[model samples]
Target: MNWMEDGMTSIPNVLLQNYKRLQIEEKEMMVLLHIYSFTQKGISFPSFEDLAERMTISSSDCAACVKKMIQKQVVAIEQGDQTGYEFYSLKPLWNKIAALFESDARGQSLQQAMTAEKDLYSLFEEEFGRPLSAIECETLALWIDQDEHDPSVIKAALREAVMSMKLNFRYIDRILFEWKKQGIKTVDQAREQGRKFRKPTGTEQVTRSENAVPFYNWLEQ
Candidate 1:
């Protein structure tokens, strides 16, 4: 065999990537990896003395690390075919790493949603030129949590209201309701609908008089 082939040992990428999430110290991880290497070389249950020989730690410390792993359920002992034999299994470790990664992904998604909700509230307050009342806040929450409206779509509706010179909650609410009725779920869809809604009728120019606001009547639609 080539020298490179003789010396090469491969471990799962997830083991390395998510080892920190395992909540184990670095030394424990080193010990775990060394055990994994031993298993790859066909040694399922290397003696603690043998492990200590490969590392700078004492045999008792190696045993202690293995014990901790066993307590954490990341490693287990299984009986060998021979009555007096046993070995370490790393199955739980891989399972734990995968679960941690999955949980982290969910946590990140939920955090992004929460941040977007806060931003939506702040945007509304800024546009309305005052802090929102409790009922207004609840209405926004209902649109997101109950009606399942996307924050971006709601923000687009707010912009549409501003452009139409109808910067009020009732008009914005009507706009959202109309968009939902039309099955518009995205900001792009809402924009397209807005363009069509504002298309010039015959030779009439789209403009507002001093006492009249030119706006799409979403309430009637």
Candidate 2:
């Protein structure tokens, strides 16, 4: 309808892929798009009123939208060099979108990892002879999700607890804690550590499956 520049303004492809998924409203998108347009046309840091007037939105609404965009990590503010003007940087938005794709492409691996986690959960329940408590489940989830512990390492810790007649989550957690202190994060590494220590295997290999009240010594240590 109107003739201004012959070329199109360049928006990052990452933004195009993930704007809606980030819960950005149309007004917010328009705000970012307008800022991008201003940047491309060499117009710097137009006031909120400038944006509101152009978009026919209220000034407060424009400000709120920009704030929401910033909260959602889709916009950033940068101080202009000695111009007393600020710019909205879109780099974080682009980076977040790129991370989303990187995560998506690993969907297959994530599913496989989930399967391994299910197997680990089942192994614990079977060995314990009861469904895990809510607190226990949350603890295991934290070990997997927050601590990023390997399933094999967890299994080894569980096996160690079983062999030591501990048969409790706390003791298993302690074993993991001790292993982490030694940087033993894998079954192979743990096994190698065991060989390096070469302690007496006869006393620690008893496979106690009987239900018993767990001791707090491990936690104390």
User: Top TM-score: which candidate number?
Assistant: 1
Best by lDDT: 1
lDDT of 2: 0.81
Tell me the TM-score of each prediction against the true structure. Answer: 0.76, 0.47
Tens digits of per-residue lDDT for model 2, 31-120: 888888777777767678988877978989889998988898888898878986777787888788878888887997889899999999
Off by over 4 Å in 1: 1-5, 11-18, 58-60, 78-87, 205-221
Clashing residue pairs in candidate 2, if any? none
Question: What lDDT score belongs to each candidate, Candidate 1 first?
Answer: 0.86, 0.81
**TM-score of model number 2:** 0.47
Off by over 4 Å in 2: 1-7, 81-84, 112-221
Q: lDDT at 109 for candidate 2?
A: 86
